[model samples]
Target: MGFADELFDLTGKVVLVTGGSKGLGREMAFGAARCGADIVIASRNHDACAEVAREIEAETGRKAMPYSVHIGRWDQLPGLVDAVYERFGRLDVLINNAGMSPLYDSLESVSEKLFDSVMNLNMKGPFRLSVLVGERMAAAGGGSIVNVSSTGSIRPNAGILPYAMAKSALNTMTEGLAKAYGPTVRVNTLMSGPFDTSAHDWEPESLAEGVRPHALQRIGTPSEIIGSVLYLISDASSYTTMATLRVDGGIP
Candidate 1:
């Protein structure tokens, strides 16, 4: 194979993507499968995950396993990890892409339940999964872990304060894990900007205002994320680790 083609190839790799049922997670799962990785699609919806898994197998001719579990629930993660290893034999990449940022009226109205839910999914779960998986990856040679974070972590506002806090913690965890699992397993953060996904209710006016601060002056497309995902997961980023690669539209 050509150098560029070989660099991005994932012939025998196994990738597990959380929240793989829809949105950016779905796109990343497809992208990885297309490049020759067997995929594990984990999400809360069993049918939805199965549907995506089927499509991935049909289109890419790669093995795709659908797993259902709530990422926020810490107790459920061990089973998910076991299922992947049992089916795939090994996991070469993990994309912690499942996250939620619920809307609330005001800072005063944000309940402890809401805050804890945000932290559990966005921070706690990812950490537990990484510890479980990263240790194995380190022992079995090496692997890549991409923690999907948001620009809001650094650019926090009252609107997304709790979610932003969680993401910020995720960012810090990525760096720490990189050191803990090195020099074999790679750990990094994929800091994203606003994208036009089902996750957002992007009205025209809101969309326009959202992208105003970006240098690209536009919201990113789901497909546009594939390049960054591929780069981080594949050997293309061999020299990269313990870094936060921003896929944002140059939000400054």
Candidate 2:
């Protein structure tokens, strides 16, 4: 095979994507499947996960499993991992794509409850999942981890203090895991800008306005994010780790 053709192949790989029911998670799950990876879709919604899994299987002719778990609850992660291992035999990739963004007026206005919820899901959840999966990857000799972050983490947005803070912590966790896991496992964060996904609760008009200043002059679609995700998960990024790949359309 040509170098480029060989580099992106994911045959025989098993990938688990959190928040895989909708939005970018769904897109990434399908992308991995298209590249020849069996996928496990994990989210809090069982029906949604099943639906996405069916779609992936139909489109890619690959095995897709639906798993329901609240990633924010670290206690539930072990069982989820076990389920993946039991079903797939091994896991080769982990995509921490699950997150939440709640609107808060200001830093002071942020409630303790909101802060905890954001941190638990956005930061702590990914960290816990990585740790659990990283062990398996290390034992298997190697794997890849993709953490989903946001531009708000890099360029703080006013009503999103809690969300940004959690994502910021997630970025740091990505770096730390990359180093700690080392030559065995590669870890990276994808700092995303505005992307139109079904998971987002924002209205279309407001979401579009949010990304008008981006270099692309438009918000991204789920398809736009899939290429970057595929690159990170596939052999194309074999030597890459402890990196943050920004897919923000040049937004500062």
Candidate 3:
């Protein structure tokens, strides 16, 4: 097979994408489906997940199933894994894309509840889910994991200290996991810049204003992130692990 043919083809592989109902999650799920991987989308919204799954199936003619679970519970992850195995038989890739960043005042004003909520969802949830999936991947010989981190983790953004801290920890965990599960289960993180997603639901104007400084000079689309996701999951990145790929539109 040609280099391009062998590197990008995902035929017969199964991928599980958390938070795959909307935004970047939905886009990546569709992208994987297009690349010939059967997809299992896990999110808290069943209706939204079903809608996206139907759309992927229509567009790519690949199998897509939606499972609703709150990963932060940790307890809920096993059931979600079981559901994926039940539906897809085996998982070859995992995209820990689901995340939350609730608005908070300042670091001095940050509440314990808010801090824990952000850390639990953004950091702890992905770690727990990875453990569950990594074990299966190891037993099956090999697999790939892509954690969706944020640029805020490296470059702090005011008023969201907890979110940044959790993402920073997640980035660290990505490197740790890659080493711990090395030579079998490849793990990496994508440190993304500002993107226009559900943030519009909170601060529409600020969301629009936040994209001005990037090299792209515009907000990124969910489709833009899918390229990096595809590379990490496919054999194109066979030699890459313990790395953080930035898709941040040149945000320094």
Candidate 4:
């Protein structure tokens, strides 16, 4: 491998990414696979995960396993971890990428179920899974964990107040986990802004308007997120942990 490629190589690593069936999670899974990492792509959609897994293996020659999972349900998480460790025998990287932000008429009108659902999916699930996997990672030597946060965490919008709140907490947990499981395990947050997922039915004009305030003046593409993903999961960020890399296209 060339020097640059060698820096981000994940030849024997096994990575688990929640919400890996589509969008940013899909992109990260492909990036990790391309860098030679075995992948466990988990999401609510089994068929979608399987398709991505096939793509990963065909493009990278790395094993990609698709597992159906609803990350919000706490009861389902233990099995997810067990399945991965049992299959891969080891997990070197974890990306908590599953999230939900439901629209509500007002924060006061948000239903209890909706609020809890957002929190459970975005915060509680990641917390429990990280504790389970991170402890193992520490015992086994070392590993990396990436929490995907949203710009709404800091730039809260009324439409997604609950989701933003959960993400804000996630950002805090990212740093705290780094301290709690550091020296051997690196924990960080990817504070992502907006990205244009082609799968979305969003109109091009509306998408452009949304990116007007960003310094780059354009929404991000999925490929743009891979650099930071690769860096955090590989030796390139050896000295970096407990940090937030805002890949937000400069939301100025």
Candidate 2 wrong stretches, greater than 4 Å: 1-3, 201-212
Could you tell me how far off, in angstroms, the CA of residue 145 lies in candidate 2 after the best superposition? 0.4
Model 3: per-residue Cα lDDT over 1-252, one tens digit each: 677767888999999999899989888998899889999988899999999989999989999998889878788999999988988789999999988887766778888888887888899999999999998998899999999999889998786678889999999999989987888999999888877687545365775576666777676877898889999999999999988999988885
Top model number, lDDT? 1
Which lDDT tens digits does candidate 4 get at residues 157-233?
A: 88878989999999999988999898899999999988877445568788889888899998788889999889889
Better of 2 and 3 by TM-score: 2
lDDT-better candidate, 3 vs 4: 4
Model 3: number of backbone collisions: 0
**Candidate 1: residue 47 Cα off by (Å):** 0.5
TM-score leaderboard ranking: 1, 4, 2, 3
Residues 61-170, candidate 2: write the lDDT tens digits.
99999999999998999999999999989999999999998776777888889889889999999999999999989989999999999988989867787889899998
lDDT, candidate 2, equals 0.91
TM-score of each: 0.99, 0.94, 0.93, 0.96
lDDT of 4: 0.92
Q: Give stretches of model 4 more than 4 Å off.
A: 198-206
Per-residue lDDT for 84 in model 1? Answer: 95
